[model samples]
Every structure is written in C-alpha cells, then in structure tokens.
Target: MKLRVFNIIKNTKVEGPGNRYCIWVQGCSRHCRGCQAVHTWSHKGGELYDVEVILDDIFNQKDKIEGVTFLGGEPFEQAEALGIIAQKVKEKGLSVLCFTGGKLEELRENQINKKLLDNTDLLIDGKFIEKLTDYSRPWCGSSNQRYHFLTDRYNEEIFTKYKNKVEVNISKNGQIFMNGMGNFDEILRKVDLMGIK
Candidate 1:
C-alpha cells in the first residue's frame, strides 16, 4: 500500500513521547476553522510512498526513535494505508501515535479506521476548535480533544510533564518548524517576526 504523504520529520521530540518520526499524510475532508495545518486540508497534491519503504526508513532509526506518529491531513482519512504502516511498526517493537479530527466512536464504526486505531498506542482525537484552544494539556489542540491510551505503552502521568510546552526546530537550511498542540497562531506570529525563513 502507498500513503499520500504531505511531509515527514525524521526526528522530533514534540509530536509524541521521546524522539519520533512524524508523518503528515495528505488530504483532510474536515476543514475546521482556524486549523493550523490548513495547507494539508486539500487532497490534490502530495507525494506518494510505498508503505514498506516508509517502514524501512523508520526501522533504520529505530534505535534513535521511540515511535512513529501519524498526523494529518486527518490520518483516519487514509486509515488503510496508515493501518498497514502501524501494524508493521508494532511488529518491530515500536509504538504508534495517531492524531485525528474524528471522534473515537465515529471511527470505530468503520473497519479500516478501527484497524488503524487498534494499531495505535495513543490517539489524540477531535476537530480543532479554535474557541476552545487549550495550552494546559499535552498533545491536544483544544479542551474538547482527548487523549486515548489504547495500549499500555505510555503512562498517563507522563503527560503532566509536557503540559503547555512546544518544540521549535530550525532546519539546516534556515527554515523553522514547530510541533505542539496549542497556540499555533501565536507561535507562527513569533516565527514570522523572527523572519527565520
């Protein structure tokens, strides 16, 4: 299977616990207002990569990464493709974290989405509600979103340490990127003022 990928961050500390390989898949049907990744909402453009190839890359850095994270354009939208990758990640003894705009109950009704969920170690679910934006929770965009620990790989208590935190990285080429669930616009504004890229 091939996944329509928007971008990939080889090493990151903010997407989930520890160091992670983050994959932002292409296409999201839910165009939530004030979404930080609005560029990812469209399904039209993105590169496609075979699932095995992606798995191979992740495995290569298995020693350096705790797990892989599946982010939008709504990971559940490409559930089948990500499901395959998640399963293989498990076989390699790595965990999976998926961020989605869909509710858990709604996802369970679909077989493909269920498979993706089953393979996930943790899930951050719900649409990004700008009005309810929260900065106190770890890995949640808003107060309405939730963290579902589907597997026992991660302890809930660990989240308390990450509350209200954000990670910013400057690439070798001088481009800046940030990973966090809160205050996206504020962070962007700061980045813009810095004129880093």
Candidate 2:
C-alpha cells in the first residue's frame, strides 16, 4: 500500500518520547484553525511512498530511535496504511505514537483504525483550538487536546518527563523546517531577525 507523505524525520526528540522516527502524512480534511501544518492539508500536495519503504526506513533507525510517530494531515485519514506500519513496528518492540484531529470515540467506530489504535502506545486527540491554546502539556498545543495512554509504554509520567519544545531541521533542500509545539510564527520571526536564513 502507498501512503501520501508530507515529510519524514528519521530521528527527532521533541515529537515524542525519546528519539523518534516521525512521519507527517499528507492530507487533512479538517482544516483546524491555527494549524501549523497548513502545507500538509492538501491531498495531492505531497510525495507518495510505499508502506514497505517507510517501514524499512523505520527499521533502519530502530536501534537509534525509541519508537515512531504518526502525525499529519490527520493520521486517521490514512488509517489503514498507517495501521500496517504501526503493527509491524510494535512487533519489533518499537512504540507507536499517533496524533489526530478526531476524537478517539469516533475513531474507534471505524474498523479501519483497529490495528493502528491497538498498537499505538500514545494517541493525542482533538483538534487544535487557537483560542484555547495552552502549551502546558507535551506535544499538543491546546488545552482541549487530550492524551490517551493506549498502552503501558507511556502514561501520566509524560507530563513530568517531557515538555513542549521545537526542533529546527534544515532539510536537504535547504528549507527551514520546524516541528513540535510552540508559537511557530514568533519563532520564525526571531529566526528571521537573527539573520540566520
């Protein structure tokens, strides 16, 4: 199966617990307000890669990364393909953390999400509400967003163990990419003022 992908970071610390291989899948129907990844909202916008290719990349970094993260364009949008990758990674003792704009209740109703949900170690749900924005928690930016510890791999301890942070990745194309939770625009503004670009 093929998955539309916006970008993939082979290893990153701020996205989830420890070092993680993060996949930002392409296409989000829910255009949540103040979404940082507006570029990923188009269905036809990103490159497509075979599921096997993504899985191979994850495995290649297995020894270095603690797990893999599926964030998007809503991850649930490409649930089936991600489910396959999620399950395979779990078998290798790699944890899975997924982010979604949809509620877990609604997602559970769809049979397509079973494997992905079942294997997910941590699932962050709820759309980002700009007005309710609060970065007190890890990863998520809104007070409304909730974290579900789907498995024992992670839990309430994350509140103390991790903090919201961002990583600046200068991609192979020389594009400045930022990931994680924070005031992205302000950060970019500072970067611009610094004459870094």
Candidate 3:
C-alpha cells in the first residue's frame, strides 16, 4: 500500500514517550478550527511512498527510537497503509503511537481500522477544540482529546512522565519546522520579542 506523507521526523522526543519516529500523513477532512497544520490538509499535496519503503526507514531508525508515532493530516485516513507499517514495527518489538481526530468508538465502527488499532500501543483520539484548549497533558493539545492504551506498552504513567512540549527543527536549508503540542502562538510571540538572530 502507498501512503501520502506530509512530513517525517526520523527522531523526536516531544512527540511521544521516549524518542519516536513521527510520520505526518497527508490530508485531513476535519479541518478543525484553529488548526496549526492547515498545510497538511490538501490530499494531493504530499509525496507518495510505498508502505514497505516507510517500514524500511522506520527500521533504520529503530535502534535509536523507542517507537513510531503516526499523526497527520489524519493517520486514520491512511489507516491501512499505516497498519502495515505499525504491525511490522510491533513485530520488531517497537511500540506504535497514533493520533486521530475521531473518537475511538467512531473509529472502531470502521472495519478498515482493525489492523491499525490492533497494532497501535497508544491511540490519541478526538478533534482539537479551540475553546477547550489545554496543554497541561502530554502530546494532546486540547481537552477533548483522550488517550487510549490499546496495548501493554504504555499507560497512565505518561501523565506524570511527560508534559506538553515542542521541538524546533532547522534544516540545512534553513527551513524551520515545529512539532509536538503546546501554545505555539505564544511561543512564537516570545521568540519574536527576543529577536534572536
């Protein structure tokens, strides 16, 4: 299966428990208000790659990462392709963490989600609600989102072990990309005031 990918970070800590390989799949139908990733909403915008190729890349980084994380445009939109990668990764003894804007019950109703859910160690669900925005918890940006421990890999300890944070990545060409969850607007505002060169 081929997956439309918006971006990939070979390793990042703030995205989940321990270091993780994060894949931001392309396209989202939710378009929730105040979404920071409008750039990922276009279904046709990102490059396509075979699931095997993605699995290869994940394996290459397996030694350094604790697991893989699927966040998106909407990971469930490309569930089957991601499921292939997730199941393979789990077989390798690495965990899988997935984020979706839809609730768990709603997702469970879809037969295509079986493989993905079965393989995902941690699943974060629910759309971002602007008014209910709260960053106290780890990873999830809004209060409406809930975390599900589908496997024994992770549990409620995450609440005490982690907190909302962001990682700043600057590529060789000077492109700055930020990931993870928090109040980005305020963070950027503070950065602007500092005027760092």
Candidate 3 per-residue lDDT, tens place, 74-172, comes to 999999999899999999999999999999999999999999999999999999989999899999888889999998889999999998889877678
Q: Can you tell me which runs of candidate 1 are displaced by over 4 Å?
A: 192-197
Q: How many residue pairs clash in each candidate?
A: 0, 0, 0
Q: Which parts of model 3 have CA positions greater than 4 angstroms off?
A: none
Per-residue CA lDDT of candidate 1, range 1-197, in tens? 88999999888887888889999999999999888898888898789999989988999999999999999798988899899999989888889999989899999998878778889999888998889977677777788998898999987886676655577878898777777666766787877898863
Give me candidate 1's TM-score against the actual structure: 0.92
Q: Comparing 1 and 2 by lDDT, which wins?
A: 2
lDDT of 2 by residue, 34-70 (tens): 8989999999999999999999989999999999999
For model 1, what is the C-alpha lDDT against the true structure?
A: 0.86
Q: Candidate 1's error at 56, in angstroms?
A: 0.7
Q: Which stretch of 10 consecutive residues in model 1 shows the poorest summed lDDT?
A: 158-167
User: The CA-based lDDT of model 3 is what?
Assistant: 0.92
Q: Candidate 2, TM-score vs. the true structure?
A: 0.97
- Clashes counted in candidate 2 amount to 0
Instruction: Give the lDDT of residue 168 in candidate 1.
Output: 82
Superposing every Cα of model 2 onto the true structure, what RMSD results?
1.0
